[model samples]
Target chain A: MYKHTTDGLRTLLNIPDNYQIFFLSSATEIWERIIQNCVEHTSFHCVNGSFSKRFYEFSGELGKKAFKEEAAFGKGFYPEKFEIPAETEAICLTQNETSSGVSMPVADINKIREKNKEALLFVDAVSSLPYPEFDFTKIDSTFFSVQKCFGLPAGLGVWILNDRVIEKAKQLEAKKVLTGTYHTISSILSKAKDNQTPETPNVWNIFLLGKVIEDMNKKGIATIRKETEVKADMLYNYIKDSNNFSFGVEDPAHRSKTTIVANTAIPAPEVNKKLEQFDLAVGSGYSSYKEKQIRIANFPAYSVEKTEELVNALKKTIG
Target chain B: MYKHTTDGLRTLLNIPDNYQIFFLSSATEIWERIIQNCVEHTSFHCVNGSFSKRFYEFSGELGKKAFKEEAAFGKGFYPEKFEIPAETEAICLTQNETSSGVSMPVADINKIREKNKEALLFVDAVSSLPYPEFDFTKIDSTFFSVQKCFGLPAGLGVWILNDRVIEKAKQLEAKKVLTGTYHTISSILSKAKDNQTPETPNVWNIFLLGKVIEDMNKKGIATIRKETEVKADMLYNYIKDSNNFSFGVEDPAHRSKTTIVANTAIPAPEVNKKLEQFDLAVGSGYSSYKEKQIRIANFPAYSVEKTEELVNALKKTIG
Candidate 1:
């Protein structure tokens, strides 16, 4: 948690001393804090998946006006297509949509940043940060959870901020700040800087994450990414050749290498139930495609043997 | 997550359907949600420890006028000491102060309820809910986290609300309700009733907690409390006879059986550093007493063997 919250930002993102960062117990807490803190001006939501859509909904509940540019799930929004309103103060995007198995390219984000210099850019990189090529220099604020790619338990969220976002947060704090026992970002930032947490943190998980990050650095992030890509490719190839299965997202370029989302002709719930009987648990589709799709994650820690077992189980269950 | 979010309140707190309830992610979230949703007139905070003090701070930040009945950190507030202000909309109290190892008796809350029927009573039971003696019938809202006596990892918070609190929430939702991705009480409650979560929850920890709760039910809450008391007694007995050790909170009746807060004649940070060598990690003092105090928790699942090992290590370090 220490490395991800502090030095990790310095190394991965060119986080300057002027920028202030805060940690939340979860990425979802980030959205709650954003609504409570930064909801004065209109926020623009460029959504392609469930998580981003949820954020747009959250902004509305806070009585904040929002301009939304949403594509079909698993499709990315081109930067040129985004029409930001004059009142837009923030642009929110999910760098990678884990549930749909798609990611927005860096070029797209750069284009958006070039267009909206005044609007703060916020990215949800929960499932993409450590394994994928993510440069924090492009966004104003980015948030990631420890559980997804960091190989740590789900409890803590690491949020990185640029100087502009920090300025915005300071302005918000001066207003109607809702300081709670565990949800105070200002309190969390003070403790996080000291390698501590405001409330009783998941100390065991934080200890383990430090070890995981150390191990990752030793192994090299490039090597880990390469291995993950190969694992994802192997599964994608199998799905392509299979007569009964098809990829959920139409565009190959938009598909996520970390999570493989597939559509089966059969009902997803039935297939999921059958897969579970074989002791193989696959993610059932969420939202619109709930009954029609299933997601298989090829995270960094998933060994080749386990991947093979899952493939074998899939073959047997589908057959 | 399912049992607690759905049936835990009904089963554990015996909350009738006639008494509406709401679910929040954490106790802190509840405070903010209450301010955003239920603040009307003014709130009264019984400030005796960190949790209650934090609530008073929250009200101040929200720009809501609140009255604080100040008591020392280790003592409970006498409900009859002050007349409830006619403008007071709610009365908040921390059932147990984890930092001070102090718990307020339920009868004290009942006394407040009798005196101020117009003011809704809120309890921060983060450290005391799971104890066998915690009766839920007297308060309007009670919240706790899974990490404390629940023996579950931290991420999710457990909360119970009476009809009055629920009615207040409903009234606010009818007005301008604050929406949250993970911290929204409405989202958690809606999904919880169906054994689901608003967003992706900490599945592994939630699964572990289900198992732990099942084990607790089998063991019985009364038996669990009795065992914890015995464990506290054994550790406190050792502390009482030790030459260099002393209880931080002087009041015997107010001391927490779950968390034994002790102040050593020696500097705390120095003694804590020494204790780390034995792999016995105890909590450090918060705020003003950071240099002189340490907190030892004897919650459920923390074995007697472990406590004995900690005691031996403490003796050796002090000697």
Candidate 2:
């Protein structure tokens, strides 16, 4: 079942043949893994919202020399302003910051990767997969949990990495560095070879993910990507014209295609309460923006008609 | 939802108020956590089977001084002659060996605890939970994945530990020792205080576990344990006199009540094939004993009547 979805995910995401896909507990666990397996000393991070900033903190907590180029909660890091340490062994970035509804553009991520050729680039696509067309060659690894665009419950995380990532862990092992014991890169590789994991995995979730991938494959990736753009555009255009709300993220280019955040005039709870009347539920502002912002996910589960209904409901809701 | 299950588990198992129940990825992962958080220098393992041996290996992988009192496969260690190092900070034991169908007597576990007063006692109850009425006061920590005995699909692991385990982690942290970053004991406590986990957990399975616990509580633990013993005795007695099978574990006292194993005259698969006609299935022996043995799980899911039917089918197939 692990191999079935792993292969389906490869086809669904256009994951390269060179990359190996494995499962972990969650995307957050991968933060510790990247630090343990790849970084020997210094690791760098592009910190913006809660999740990206946590990657940096995880490195620091592991006694690694962690350096980061920080940004505000609703902001993002640009490749032009990145000040990574010269000794950094790995560069961590979040493709989509679910907390702030901000996305670091894929082109910008590729630019950072080009600049740090010697370092392993780890991308956290935790809440924004199947919607993003990643150039797999540009990054050494990328991971996501099923709760996001895949629309399953959140227990299983998919880790996609190249052979270079495995070799990096081997090199660290040879140098007597502790790259962890269970779910280490080498263990993942060995267990994956047998269609097994070191531990009894969440078998149910893997089976569910395979079924989801089969459905998505039937719908087609290009079509899903196109529908995501159209729905996101519809919601963004409606929120732009609404009297009650404006964009949560300041930069239009950095706005996420899957998670759309809005800065509301009224308290976010009131907006949620009004939306509840129409049975349209969206997330309240995360962390510091709890009072003024509302977040909506434009996942595969949301159809064009449903998104249109949401926009129509918002028109009546805010007024 | 995590709290709901954690609370239900406490009630179902009569887990002490002093012991905290938290969830992890799997029981195997907890082996790594034990080595990291509790063992600052040395960990001792009672290595009798595949799973128990792996716990000792995990300590070595994490750069800890690992010591083990070894026993042969399908055998168990008695507390009569333990050569545990004085420097050992934690003592590890597997209450039930899934691979070998051997269980360490809980009385002996308490004896070991009495001898190693200063060291934390950790129990791996992976395949034998809701059956072993543990002396939680005698053990600092114990863990089990929901797949076994709990009768759920594998993925989530439940870690039950005391305040002393948390204090040990803090002491290590104070001394500039690494006890992992994501799942360090202190982080589990801090996040658990907020009724949250550091990672997005398997929310669905946790919910399922709560539902299962509610059912188990309805049945009552004492009734379940009695049923388990009754069913196990029926199967073991039938196997002992059968033409085709004999006891897998030499010592009757060491034979597991939950996981009952037998040495088969035919290959395990042929036995399984014979049983299949009666709509019954059993596990092939793990690893080295795969050909000559069969393992039957006597979990809460089994009824006395159903077990009798299985026993009757075994008779017909063997004859």
Highest DockQ: give the candidate number: 2
The 10 consecutive residues of candidate 2 chain B with the worst lDDT sum are B77-86
Best-matching candidate per lDDT: 2
lDDT by residue (A117-194, candidate 2, tens digit) is 888889999888988888988999999989999999889998999988889999999999998998788888899988
Task: Score chain B of candidate 1 by TM-score.
Answer: 0.86
TM-score per candidate, chains pooled:
0.84, 0.98
The list of candidate 2 runs beyond 4 A from truth reads none
TM-score of chain A of 1: 0.86
Q: Where does the lowest 10-residue lDDT sum fall in candidate 1 chain A?
A: A176-185
Top-TM-score structure, candidate number: 2
